[model samples]
Target chain A: MPGQTTASLPRVAITTGEPAGIGPELTLMLAMQAATLPAQVVAIGDPDLLSSRARSLALDIDIVPCRPGDDLPAPQAGRLSVWPVSLRAPSLAGTLDPANGAYVLDTLDLAIAACRHGQASAMVTAPLHKGAIIDGGHPGFTGHTEYLRDACGVDEVVMMLATDQALHGVAHGDTSCPLRVALATTHLPLRDVADALTAERLERILRVLDGDLKRHFGIVSPRILVCGLNPHAGEGGHLGREEIEVIEPTLNRLRTEGLDLTGPLPADTLFTPRHLATADAVLAMYHDQGLPVLKYAGFGRGANITLGLPLVRTSVDHGTALDLAGKGTADPGSLRVAVSLAADMARHGQ
Target chain B: MSQAQPCIALTLGDPAGIGPELVAKLLEQRDVVGKANIVVVGDRWVWEEGQRVAGIHHEIPEISSLAEARDQTGPVLLPTSTIKPEDVEYARINGLCGTSVLEVLKLCMDGASAGQVDAICFAPLNKLSMKQGGLKHEDELHFFVDHLKVETPVCEFNTLGNLWTSRISSHIPLAEAASHVTSERILSATQLIHDALIAAGIEQPRIGVAALNPHAGEGGTCGREEIDIIAPAIDACRDAGYAAQGPFPADTIFRRARDGEFDGVVTMYHDQGQIALKLMGFERGVTVQGGLPIPITTPAHGTAFDIAGKGRANVEAMRHAFDIACRMGRHHASR
Candidate 1:
């Protein structure tokens, strides 16, 4: 506790995502047990929604109202600080409404603004309903990472998921460190993944991944394991030629530039402990190739971090469980880990 | 099976690969003897080579025939072919090694058909060698389907502990994977895994179907494959009286299955399930040749030609494959 004084704790802005979903309750759950974390979390959503959810969940967290740049107090048990953004319409648990779409984006904007203005060290987001947001107005909204990338005016950002839990692969033995999986292509259809993985894009993604592992995660020279775009990594051009034509050349180029990168290896064999034990992270060709293993290894406890951003940001690895909204049954494990990771990243960046 | 000890035929998979060492290591285990009445159905010289390379030995009773193996309680070697160990190469794709491997597997299949053996489990085999050895089919699953001579539908089911996965498409380009995600294929895959689960002793297996697109097509915004293809197939599967859910996102379906939300997963592509299953438990994964009349299983890995003769092969998957064969053999016997 000597080193973890109030002044030393990083301030993390927690955006309570979809109002009708589990975000409000998960935020309250995290705030109720906030004393255990290394950061001071400020919830950036409607205060009325928080209070109502708290009452409904029977959590006795005292909602202390504050602004983003206000001198934040140290986290205490049963006390939570809030930077309130008013909701357009009242929301009920497990119900979706069109009016609250802009409110969700408003909360994210405030969190981004806080992080950019140095008012907060990092931001952790709860899950928001993409459908509700689209129905509420903006049809082009894909995900929080893209929205943040556009809001921050960055050309690229890497989506990396990590958990500190060791992958005891039952029989392949254990990984010594956390399993981190980053995607070269995030949310594309299966058919488009091959075309999306150009050499130029791969080089840029690798640079972002390598640079962020240094600048944010404190890894000096991160070792990355990359997966091939095809099955058996094209089986030496018999299955598909992306590995030979694209992934191999790109990795070789990056290696010449003195980045520690390994393989255009088979995706099926890439996630095992033998390959994972010494590596810092795995760069998969597509979303499903990397994340299924990452999510399986660290389900409900993994935190998703956006790399190459101007400010540190982390989020829960799950979607908003509308059915569990206001029921006090949502798991706060991922959110807590996200907050802790953001705090660590913030401190590491300093 | 009537004597409460189901007989199983085991083969040293590609002789040049780690299969021999793995089988040798497996024979050295004490618990394996009590699990099944195993008869090593490969050449005696190759078996000896495996034992020598693995630095372990067990005195398995040598028998000239399968009938002789049935009378013994402990493991026995049938000695199908005799080839000098010096003539064989380790890890390379040789036609002779592949032909010998196939001959041994064929003997086991014939044994199962003739009621001499209840199930079959082999060590890791090399597909390239098998291809060189005149394996006309895509892989062994097709060979099994063809040899068994009767098939409604069949697929390779990769199991890691209680969670099992069957993909609708495998070994093809990822570009062509989307084309194979038709309702007919999904239903067949769903039905195949369901019946296989039942045969393996799980009654009423709950199968979770995976979407081909990322984020499950995002309600038709990102891709419509989930809405137009996967979801309809899931509906068709349900209508056919199978307990299946999803068109869930491929990335999270395995996680839910791992957590026991479902007993099996039907993946739309090869790596969707493979990436997760191998990551979860690589050394313990078992590949079951689903829809065959007889229970057949092998390690869900290939011959580690790189570490073949070094005797560094992990025999965990081999042991698990044997255990699964035993479980399924009991069910097959009862049926």
Candidate 2:
């Protein structure tokens, strides 16, 4: 429907994360709706686990076991091409086992390798259980972004969440543009958010946000709206000094280098349609400031994209939903969007 | 005028700001005039300037005192102080204008104390102007607390449509927000909003408290504020018989509230609730001064100095402020 013939469709590799969680069923659900998707999706997990989950969910897809770079059949419903990896321990739905933790990491490593070797155009990931991975003996397991950064040997990557659902009439300068929010700092205490924002860090984050919008999103010169660390953007130092000391200085230096950046504006007013309508992306100073609004605007329908990466990777904006795993009611909306976004980014590269 | 109508004292917030023009736009609406016995309290010349900026005029009768305005319905002007139209500097903060704004609000507060007014809905005020106008307190709420001699807890409740939010710490440094997340403050904010929502006609409001840390501290790996501070305060709220839930992660809690999961949310700091509420509806948000003896409300927006005297301020927030004041005033009147 989007002018892609079946042979020319880009290949998207999806990892079934945290086998005990809803990742397997969500993957199977995505495969069943392959005709509506923009790319050829290959589920990179244990073929047996997907088959079991598919049976439980009553899906009628044929789980064809294939390898990376295999000549897969044309896109069709009820036909899933799986680059099979064996599970170290059999996984049960709705039950987390640390024994299968390495299995989860194995799936990710395989997807990364495949994408690196040109076997897949891009990779989309479902949610993984951090606790299981940590307990299964990788003590420094922080998150998927950190894992990918380390696996790829990159110094840093920006976590940006976006949704095709238009926030307002003029959101992102168009009625149909997606709202993208990238954080300068992630997963620190509220008290530590200020200390984490140095001039160097802000410069690097802004550069990455700007560069990736051009390289990945196809925006030639991205206009990013930045948020200040303090309330009312420090209200000209009556509220706080971060805007004066750190944010403004960094933005001024970058602006002279020809970056189209605005604000040190108030976070409360920055997310409004008046300002958001003019941004390609927003760089919030911390996690809570930008995310709460983005999630509220596009929860359950958003995709989490990792910028500054050597390869294009997108993930669902939600979690594994361990409670609703076996119940077959977990929504595949985010995974579908993630795969669709990854497909778009792959096409952009081409 | 009908005795059934409650008297509302409306002040032109900061003469330099767009408050006067917004109040002037609000007065042109016939339905707002018919709902309450509206008394416009400010300098007569400034009120006329608002009318001129708004490009509208009304023959509001002049009242010499609050006692005269108490019995009259429709829009009545009580010129407590004088500022000439030529002396008014639009969009520039002046001590004289600030002092005049404080005096006008003080008169209304005194009238409210004397039972001469049921509610007070003022236009947006400039904090720096008020401070330059000789305000000793950090903000107007503190000034009101001192003036009204309120010994109990007080917080500002921001409402968008049906969802209400109150914060424990506001107008402080982000670094210091964690230090203010004590159990005592959270309970105080919860109690205040719970009572205020009831007074505003919500029966048994369910309040959702936000976690102070990210992912609710991820079970104390990231920060201890959620475990050590926020949860205990939420427990205290439950024991106190208020329908309260969560120390939910700040990011997703607002979505739940927006989707009708809760009637209100009590946040640990300002931007946690503000970033969500303003994004949800910036033009329709109203700020209600909670735990006050008399009902007080204002537009949650500030004095838009960039567009002051442009005669194009959106009057929806101002109108909602008036409607809330009238609603709360009616409840206060019946009680």
Candidate 3:
């Protein structure tokens, strides 16, 4: 439970994901840099585990243990603020133990509760090994984003990977440069991407993407580019006609609603440097179709953000590297970016 | 060879496939080196083994640069390999062989970018073989696009008898393929095909757009895609000065186009055009990446991993790929 008071600072709950992965290391790394962050950050995991991780990584951070109803501690210069949620069993550095799955879930549940009760302004989640989490009896949790969605009771969410590129601006300011992409359908088998692209679904996704871009990134009217489902966008029915029959009408409908949108362009050609330079974001047809390009563009440095959620949430665009766990060598660049994005979005005040 | 022209970097596709054999058979053509410089971008041992199996006696040109083969006659080989040729077993997917193939493509593309090579032609590479090679891309073309960061729309065009260019869906699931058909996409594909044909020097190319459902939806009784969506798009393209016609029954459209009824056919999905074109002239089929700054052409077949190490691969498609690449390259160069 979080402290209740008017003066209680808004907390940003961080879930140190799967116990045996790089989650603990990344959490410790971010904790080292917590002094520079603006929001109140809290890690819902064991304090001793974080301390051990910090020691292994050669990081010096004090661990402030808190119980339920305890006042959130002011983040110290070289210390980690922890809301202790003990693990059931001892965790090995590289091996995933099924016994700690409930502990991971409990951490997330506590963080979500903090956000729901207005104790936390937003949440930054570390990577979790989905397979281990599933094998640990929490059969429904697929990935961190899905788990967050269900925990927050959001009906639908779009995953966007954002990165910044320098551009000639009107003034000497850190321009709010973001390359945002939202998928019409995600995590589906490749065979199902086309049938799943309905006009209604596409319209909804575009609308949500537009709204989120405005709210989170402060783009007044973000230009949305769409990739066609078929090859050559159906080659006028030569390759496939999903573009002609399905995608066009949906775009037409969106156009009538006055959205700045373009395409049904061939997916193969949509990711070129010239075209990508002209649009604010791209709405990809499916997972593999769009993500390969995005991942290629910003592999380990991109941040995964969930739109259409009630609270601000951003995460590292990577999975729990069980192999690299406990090595104290996990890259904290993405975690730092996720925290920065969460703070930025919170400042924007959706 | 005539003035030692720049070699067209060619990739010997899958080791288990027909790529090695195809390269062997292609090199046997005396006139191939006469057209443009040819460089085989693959393992030297693989080429030698292919030469032995194909029973073609030709000296493998061992040179680092295309300029080295400038005055010499016969095909030049720029050997690239990740593993020993002896290590690759036929018909089996080997990650090393796949990675080698990708490395070859990357090297060739790099050379082309630096003006070291004039153009490139690819032999078929198996998708599964590439997966074994640890490639994360959907296809070779996608890999190129990612590497180059090309902005122009790279579309796959299959030229059947130099008469029609067809495609709709290239690589996607069938269920998803149908829903992707849209009026705007049809219009864009029609526009690109029309522009490609005109650029190929055809004036006002006649294009036939195929219907998604059977019989152009039999006037909406069979399906509404033709009546409700496709027909309107065809009309829009016509208004834009393209001689586009269709929502024709997919079954008969290809035949009509074959009979000189239309200059090209707009297909609804991958197999729709591929089936007709492959049947018409599978051996002579050529693939063109339209809307690219440079016209990129390749043989339609992939590396035949099964017969790759053996020298039984056909060279007709490779020959056609070269012919088309040369023609397109010349056309673009002149422009």
Question: Which candidate achieves the best DockQ against the true structure?
Answer: 2
Worst 10 contiguous positions by lDDT, candidate 2 chain B? B79-88
Residue range B194-308, candidate 3, lDDT tens digits: 8888777788799999877644555554457777778889899889988888877655676677778888888877655664565455667878767665556677765654455
Share of native interface contacts recovered by each model: 0.83, 0.85, 0.12
Output the worst ten-in-a-row residue range by lDDT, candidate 3 chain A.
A166-175
lDDT of 3 by residue, A1-350 (tens): 13433233346778898888888888888777766665567788988788887777788888888754566766656777788899888887888888888888888888778777766778888877766778889787677778777877877789887654421112112333455567888766334556778888887888889888788777788788898876546545544677888889989988898888889876644555445677778898865455544443332356788888878888887778888888877888888777777767776764
Give each model a TM-score: 0.89, 0.95, 0.54
What TM-score between 0 and 1 does chain B of candidate 1 receive?
0.96
TM-score of chain A of 3: 0.88
- In the order shown, the candidates' Cα RMSDs to the true structure are 3.6, 2.1, 21.4
**TM-score of decoy 1:** 0.89
Interface RMSD of 3: 13.9
* CAPRI quality band, candidate 1: medium
TM-score of 2: 0.95
